[model samples]
Target: MDLDLAAVRAFVAVADDRYFGDAAAGLGISQQAVSKRVAKLEADLGTALLRRTPNGAEPTEDGASFLVQARALIALADQAVDLVRSRHRALRVGVLGTRIASAETVRAFHETVPDVGVEMLRSEGLADALTALARGTIDAFFGRALGDLGGIEARPVYLEPVHVLVGRGHPFAALDGVPIADLAGRSLWVPGAVRPETEWADFYRVLAAEFGVRVDTTGPNFGVDDLVERTAASPELITGVGEKIRVPWHRGVVQIPVVEPSPCYPWSLLWHPRNRHPVLPELVAFTREGFRPYRPGRDWIPEPDRPAFTA
Candidate 1:
């Protein structure tokens, strides 16, 4: 038979206080209302749950047996509510990779609010991260928001300066900084830029087209270790990396700044409008407070990402 939780709660309260007037005061309800709820509960069970005594109301033998299960039911129900409410759950954030600048930003945010737990999930790229955000698998994402954003809301967070990685014998290795024009006619080997539709690939494509830098996507795309080893072995081959990216250390490889209007990779924090995570606003506030504005004359941003940086 179906049972009303309200009536059950009223019965438990009445049993605890052992008096209808006392139970009504505890429940913030009238004595008559409490009595009616207990009466209804006893009738539904087809047994006397409580019996009036000279001192007060005492639970019957049947009421004593059912009290344990009723309390358990209330405890389980409260736990379920807390779970759905995300009372103490960690905030899940999607980042492109741990070695990139976005991951560092998330780390800094966590450090700022140490009490707020954070879970960092690595994503393939902006497209992958955005899909996770839309699916509600991730609370927020950190990446460049280009093309159609649809219902996604974004805020510019950081602009990481671009750097060139070259072998010791390479011509640019000895220089303090390589100008953007100097990269022309030079091939930038990016193993992960094979997908033309991905956000990172698209950014490099535009960088190649605008600056006359050729992006060579060679076969057998390996991880960063292979990329670092191969780049260090070849004197002529060069690759572009973000200044903040933590690449594997190689004695033969040197990282030099790409200056004279530095090319910057734009980073934005993206989240769905429907996401109601309490810590989300705190993260947004942290990013806003620490944001370093893009220098229009000194920094070079891609055309697609220009609006966000400019705005």
Candidate 2:
């Protein structure tokens, strides 16, 4: 039978308080209203649930049996409500990969706001992450914002310095920092950048076109470990990695800073304008407050990303 939850709630309150007046006080309703609700519930169930005594009311034998089920029903209803409202769900955040600089930033943000629940979703790249954000599959995303974002809101969050990775035998491996100009005509192999429309591929394309550096996209793209192993064995071939990316260690490989107007990867936090996750604002505020502004002359940012980072 379809039960009126309000009436069931009123009955539970009266059974617990043993007095309609006390139950009304707890429920912030009048005693007469509580009695009317309980009376209606009794008529619906075709059984008297409460009996008024000299001191107070007590549940009948049938009421005692139904009380347990009534409480369970209320609990299930409340859980369903909370689930739909997203009150108990963890905040879902999309990132390109767990080893990159953005992942480190997410880790730090989580530590700062330890009370807030956060779930990190590993996406392929910015394009994939933005699609997830638009579809409401993810609450927020961390990546370089490029081109038209449609209705999504984006904020420049961090500028991670770029580093050149070279085998120990390479000449630049011994240097403290390699000037950006020195990279001209040098082959920089990036295996996974073969994907055409991805964010990092576009970034590298722009960088290569502007800087005259040759970006080699040759491979059967394995993973980072394979990249690191290949880089350690090849002295002539080099690669670029973000300073904060946690690459697997190779004793023969050395990471040298890229200087003389260092090229920095611009990271931005992206979310739908309509997103109302409780942790979104906190994360945005934390990003704004903690951001280290870009140095115009000392840092080189791509043209499309400049507006967000420079401003």
Score each candidate by Cα lDDT. Answer: 0.87, 0.87
Tens-place lDDT digits, model 1, residues 50-99: 98999898888999999999888877887677557764678899987888
Worst 10 residues of 2 by lDDT: 79-88
- Clashing pairs for model 1 are none
For model 1, where is the 10-residue window of minimal lDDT?
A: 79-88
Global local distance difference test of model 2? 0.87
C-alpha lDDT (0 to 100) for residue 225 of candidate 2: 90
Name model 1 segments beyond 4 Å from true: 1-83
lDDT of 2 by residue, 193-215 (tens): 89988888888888898788888
Misplaced by over 4 Å in model 2 are: 1-84
